[model samples]
Target: MTQHVTVGIDGSVQSAAAAEWAAREAHRRGLALRMIHVAGTEADALERELGGGAELPGRVAEICDGIAAAWPGLDVTCEVQPGHPAYTLAAASGRAELLVLGSRGLGGFTGLLVGSVGLRTAARSLAPVVLVRAESGRTDAPAAATSADATSADGAPADAAPGDVVVGVEGDRPCDAVLEFAFERAADLGARLRALESRPTSHDVYTTQAPVEQAEIRESLAAAEQVRLQDALARWQDKFPQVRVEVEVCPWSASRALVEASRGASLVVLGRRTARVPLTGPHLGPVVQSVLHHAHAPVAVVPHH
Candidate 1:
């Protein structure tokens, strides 16, 4: 790992918020902070100037300076690179321990769509990617964390009590890397870990079973799911004994369950396949794509084989 946190800066409020979040995260991880602004070379400068993007460099500089002064002794650097935004950031992820980007807002990524920079970079990133949302009314993040504050994105105030770090677990396709990331993050924040698994309730129209029988069937399925989830989390729980682990087995859509869990969570984590599947899903699973767009908390997309 490169031992640094990389954040894309575009001078928007959302990007500024992302920069602030990345700075705190860098401090927590004891890593350097790198702020990169992407605009084409001299040849493309005229286009940028004509397009009214000339002021971005100055704004990026100001943001960098503010963060640097606020967190003394932090190695913060700003650079202007020339290339496509998505491709450049994806490449940077290869050399970064984590990549942070601004979510929907003015001049920020409006959506994690198929042709958008956010989705493209997240899909191709070598390291984990975190998407931060900062709207006009969003509170300014503190320069340093003085307390165990777990401000949430889903309507929780800045001074709200610490919240759990929720992680979605695919029982059938259990991913150790995803679990490891979640455990490490929970340990870092000294927060609780909620391992949630959502199952689609079975509905057999052809069956002539009684209503009581159906209830029993559903109960049995839930029990089996609970056991599976517990088994999958056993090793991780042992590894991070300090982290309080809570498991949930619900009969509902995975995306819906995850979105609901994100409401009061400090951070939401899910896994993505290392290989791109080339579909509307950004090569990421459907559930992941949905959660990325709708998640109330900052979502961490971890890549695994």
Candidate 2:
């Protein structure tokens, strides 16, 4: 079967944004788009909260229809399944090229961008999961085209120039999958690639020592880190010569740097290690969790060994 882009819809604003983003991605990858809606067991709760009928099938149909009307000629389909939301989406991810979901649900706390379903699905999905926010213009809205009526072949707004794709690098871990995904995306979009590495300030080097000593230690550490970053990216850079890469080494927490980079990025990519135990629950690092909750742009979490 042909691999397609999959997105979970739950009749919320953020989910609608995710669907729009998925449609654009499907067009970019030359793949089909699949929208899956997993109906919850609490029908009454959904009705009371969403102000809909007892069943959610109608809501799902409405969303599908809206997307179809907005972007004509795009191959789009919808499925309504009855099961736990996170598990069903995770199963669907096995067959999808990429899985997209909203950062938060309708009833989540105001401060929480990602809900339990999104968190679990991101950790459990076999494929990369992207959490998109409602205000993400690159995905949720479109940039201006050449002409007022100009649009892409798949009906997305045509951009004069695409934005850069950014990936967070953990120097201590192997991130082949993460780098591959980032490079592929940048190549597909004809955009630039940015590799960001964040290093924490070492107390051992920056303690209450002499200013000269601290400056010397910092310079030595920074030089070493730059060399390591270059070594880590050498292979990937050779593999993707067409991709223009800009590397940065920041002296801050990885999560902070990624969150800051997301402000102007088209997409931010991160990695999650698969749990060794079969029954273990979602395992997300602090950096991934922080970016998922704070990044303004779409965040892609790729699972790696």
Candidate 3:
């Protein structure tokens, strides 16, 4: 069966770029593209001005109709939903191969402060979410054209090495899957894979068994923890022999660490296997959401794969 990717669109230029990006991706992967928009008070007013019926579904159909016209041969569907944009988009993610949203939406704020829909979907959605910021052109172009766009996003100097595939790694089992996915992506792009482990705060409180004792034990356990992290990196390198790997351990929050590491990266890949890694969950995890919100590089979430 052909895969399906859903992109949130609200007729903004960024959203249009997202739609074009999704369409190009669908074409490349032989998949269908679905464009969705949640009817907020603002969107409702705009549709009314355009003589669209003052209803949620009508606005949705209007958006989808435009997408269908843009890429006549490809399969495209538009949906208008009620309630919060992030909630609806994240729920739709369960059925999609990927969920996409532009960094800035028809809503307010630009640059670092991404729209809530993009932020929430990236952090909470079960499907991989691609948070994109468009170039001066569209995503529906030939391979060489699209590649040039991708390269421009990376800001790579002509003589420098290609961009790397950056992924977050920790003690969770999900890190294993993340490493595997990142390695494959790096190999496919002929890029290096950079893995980072974000250390938690209260670093000295090493005692998990007894809260009081743990406070006193942190100093003793800190060095050992660093060694354990090094071992994890060594194991990953051993497993992916063909790929070049660089590992770093940082004492920053996971979100901050990811944002810093994502600089100049071709793609930032995050793992979403909350059942096995509950700390990274819907509506809660800061690290997952922060990367989605702040990273200038394109972010890719690997959902339980």
Best by TM-score: 2
- For model 3, residues 1-305, the per-residue Cα lDDT tens digits are 35699898765656766776676566545579987777765757576678765344443454455556545567776666756778888888898888888775222343355666676676678877887766534443322333332322223111235588888877434366667767865775678888777876563324365545654575445566666766776776787677787776667888888888877887788876545345655552556666776776777877663
Which ten residues in a row are the worst by lDDT in model 3? 151-160
Give TM per candidate.
Answer: 0.82, 0.85, 0.64
Model 2 lDDT on a 0 to 1 scale: 0.80
Residue-level lDDT tens digits of model 2 in 40-154: 6587357647865434465556667767766676788887776799999999999999999987522345456697888889989999999988762333222122123557765
TM-score of 1: 0.82
lDDT, candidate 3, residue 4? 95
lDDT (C-alpha) at residue 9 in model 2: 91
**Candidate 3 global TM-score:** 0.64
Judged by lDDT against the true structure, how good is candidate 1? 0.78
* C-alpha RMSD values across all candidates: 5.7, 4.7, 8.1
lDDT of each: 0.78, 0.80, 0.67
Q: Which stretches of candidate 3 lie over 4 Å from their true place?
A: 45-83, 105-112, 135-162, 171-174, 199-242, 251-253, 272-281, 302-305
Kindly report which residue pairs in candidate 2 clash with one another: none
Model 1 segments beyond 4 Å from truth? 40-44, 47-56, 105-115, 139-161, 205-212, 278-282
TM-score order, best first, reads 2, 1, 3
Model 2 misplaced regions, further than 4 Å: 44-59, 105-111, 136-150, 153-156, 205-213, 277-280
